[model samples]
Target: MAEARRPRAIDLYSGIGGWSLGLRLAGIEVVASYERWGPANETNFKNNHHQAQTVDIRRLSFADLPDGIDIVVGSPPCTQFSFSNRGGNGDLEDGLEDIVTFLGIVDHLKPKVWAMENVPRVAPIITKELESGGRLHAFSHLDVQTHILNLEEFGLPQRRRRCVAGNFDMERLRAYASRLERLTLGDVVVALGQDPVCDPLYGLRIPKAQLVDHDPEPALNPEELRINRANKTAHTVYNAMPFPDRMERAVRTITATCTRVSRESIVIAPPETPDCVRRLTIRERASLQGFPITFQFYGATYAQKLRMVGNAVPPAFTYLMGHVFQGTDAEALPPLASHAEHLTAPAPPAVLTPPDRPGSVFPPTRSFRFAIQSLQLKSGVRFELRNRFADGQTEWSVDFYFGTSKNIIALQMDHALRTRLVMAIPARLRREVETALAGVSTYVEAADIENMQRVWTHKGVGGTRPFMLLDELDQAGKGLVEVLQSEPEVSRAVVDAAITARFGDDRPAVGLAKLGRNAPVIAAGLLIGSAANGALRTHHLRTTGRSPKTKSH
Candidate 1:
């Protein structure tokens, strides 16, 4: 019998070798890697024992890559095409150029199998190009076998979702899918042990805060201080909370932002504890991102390490994909039962106590919709109710809290709606409001009391004027509301149009103006557009500048 051939592969934009590691694990030999980042290249070299050429993909030629490569797998830099980049902004053009160049290489080399991984939004764009070029047939060796696989379905810990497109066989991918495995945050955390935590301030080794002599009541005055106190209380339960059931199926996408910095958008782990404010440490983050414990990143700063982890493909996810591409059945292989069993056992509980009193006034809930609308006429602070009733009817209300006083400045609403309000006031007036509300239950309506007081004093006041000072609140609230209300397809269209307007148009000034006024809108449009048919079409129009109505000769 003839010996089986070891598949040869090349990785482009191979940051820290996430895809490469996965391919390597599945018995694919990564002959060469191309990457631009120095730190990532250094780490990839150290861990993979493979020398990576530091070169920008745009400037490099197909001749520069290793010849006779059986497979080519990569994830191009997504920032230009990502939702975060001002709706693809100027980067959309650049992203397209890069994609074309990349596809050009693919067409020239005509590898037996090629896989490209990127954010889900990139799929439509790639699919359009593949179909137009007639490369899809050549790549897949068939017309109908286009594959797009999600990382979540394969069972990695983090909720990092990506789209995979390739010329790989469908039967192979199906076989790989049948043997998919899921992992949770706990599975990864416990397997790695407690010593090197993701957040240095709070991980496994650092003991949870002791409850002895701890005051649970929120502080009076200094609104920022109050918020900080509330956050601390929320953290108590978040840190000790076990991984939810859904988490086992997929992990949340680890973001670049610090977990401790923002109250409005932190991932809550349940079973609260005081130590929750700390961000995930480098090690824990790496684990969550599916990097092996043995894969070490050598970086001078924490930020550098974070970038490395964030950029890399989840190795386990990649491994499964690799097996699929190679036409192998992972399930037919003997089960690694002992390895699987080691991941499920629970660790001893950390010593931490929950706060007795209301540690902070604000409760973290997903149902809140906040907006700061500087309307033409009325613009105070507006919040939309997101809470749902059993009958599906929603309630709406609005309240204004005077800074530091804890008293309702005013309340206005037509009916019960879903929204809550928290006010931040200057520290000086806290005592007065505390004194006034001394005997009142925390639940009493401050707005009602204020209205009664106004009527009793016979002071006829017109509707309250909008508070100009709440500009930031209005902006943040409106942004949130807009995001919540937007349909995925519509949002994508707007983002795509914005990006096209900015980069594709000959009138550079107009694009620049749109970017200057509201970058987020453009970003949303691009993200949405990228996910739908419009983004690619817009790109085509921008590149070719053709009107559909104009007839060809």
Candidate 2:
């Protein structure tokens, strides 16, 4: 008997042909793609070398497709089922209606295999539909298998967990599943060009750095100038903020709002070039979403690229699935030796530190309360700080876990106001928190000692806390007076004054700040400050020259 040829696939609801791309990579022939969106259809046509029909999936009949489609795959519009949708109501019934109509076509065509991908929340509904339609039993006729998979397992950098149900033989899929490689953000970013730093593999483009209003300039106010001078050298310090463990095998799901401001936040780090934005480009977004670099989109705007990336299935994941359906052992397939050259060092081990001492973690019980209440009110960390009284003494401590490692700051307080730190970390995240703290320096600043002591003295509060006070540490011990002088805000006199105040004549700050003049310190300071404060309300650190009667400093 002769060996069987690879199966043919038809992609329905194909937006820019992600499913088709994966199928093609796996050696499956994509005969046609059906899409409702015009731009997506055009882009699909451009990339696949086949014209995609701009027809609605609901109106699509089996007759519209060519014969001999061994497999059918699609990811229907999930807006109606998404929790983000206004309470997930309105047109939901219609969405289900569309799904049924789609399934009806699948049934009519009788493709040997069919797969549908969607948010995991839709699993119950899909399962119910399959049972009702006897599709589960139908799989036996074609030796079909189905599963809901997490894309992270297939080496995507983002944490996209989706449900994938298909009719394929289980034995066939297991063969390839074992050999699947794990993908990381670093793996994809490294493949980009050396100068522009755009990932060629995924067609991600880095936009030229525009001089936005937020760029380094003169401080808006005198106080800002002072702070900008003080922290001028802080701007070029990459990875100064703490990050989660870099070598962990698992990748956190990348959300629509994902950015790399804090250690907990995952960001795509382009080259240390000047003409790059901090966020991931459209092509990088697609790569992270699992689309290959060769995939070209025709949309004019970056938003279109984002839509195509967000809407499409990761090609790597789909290719793995396709291989499984074909009874091929993809994992056993020889690894691409070329890809091995890109692999970097594994992530380092995480460091664990103790929490603050009672009352010493906060300046005072009242200050601890204010800080906790402020964080809670800010809607960022949502941690609760509480003061507990035991044996006529007050105990103050923090009671929540922050999601990002970079956001962790050393707290100081008076010793008498010592209270225990209570962290309400969920069981699932305990290990991740532990891993992130490993190898990271957690020190308490002299300014924050009083506040930290107050929170650590009390009982019924204990959690993993990094002891490093990052801000107080002297990193690359160079001053910023020279850097301040170039700042748009600081006058030459102001820079000279700052330098004299710090070091009589050496002007360490000025000298160091001058190292990267094009990348001004003041601008970096403003960005860091605004990001930390969650807004740009404060920029300058001005003060009146005359001393007030009540002033102690």
Candidate 1 segments whose C-alpha is farther than 4 A from its true place = 1-4, 87-90, 130-148, 194-249, 257-259, 262-275, 333-381, 384-553
Q: Model 2: residues >4 Å from true position, as ranges?
A: 1-6, 87-91, 130-146, 193-251, 254-277, 331-553
> Where does candidate 2 have its weakest 10-residue lDDT segment?
413-422
Which model scores highest in lDDT?
Answer: 1
For candidate 2, write residues 217-327 as lDDT tens digits: 111232222223222212222122212223233445443432123222343224544232234455456667775444565665545555666777777677666776566
Candidate whose TM-score is highest: 1
User: What does the lDDT read for residue 317 in candidate 1?
Assistant: 71
Q: So what's the TM-score on candidate 2?
A: 0.51
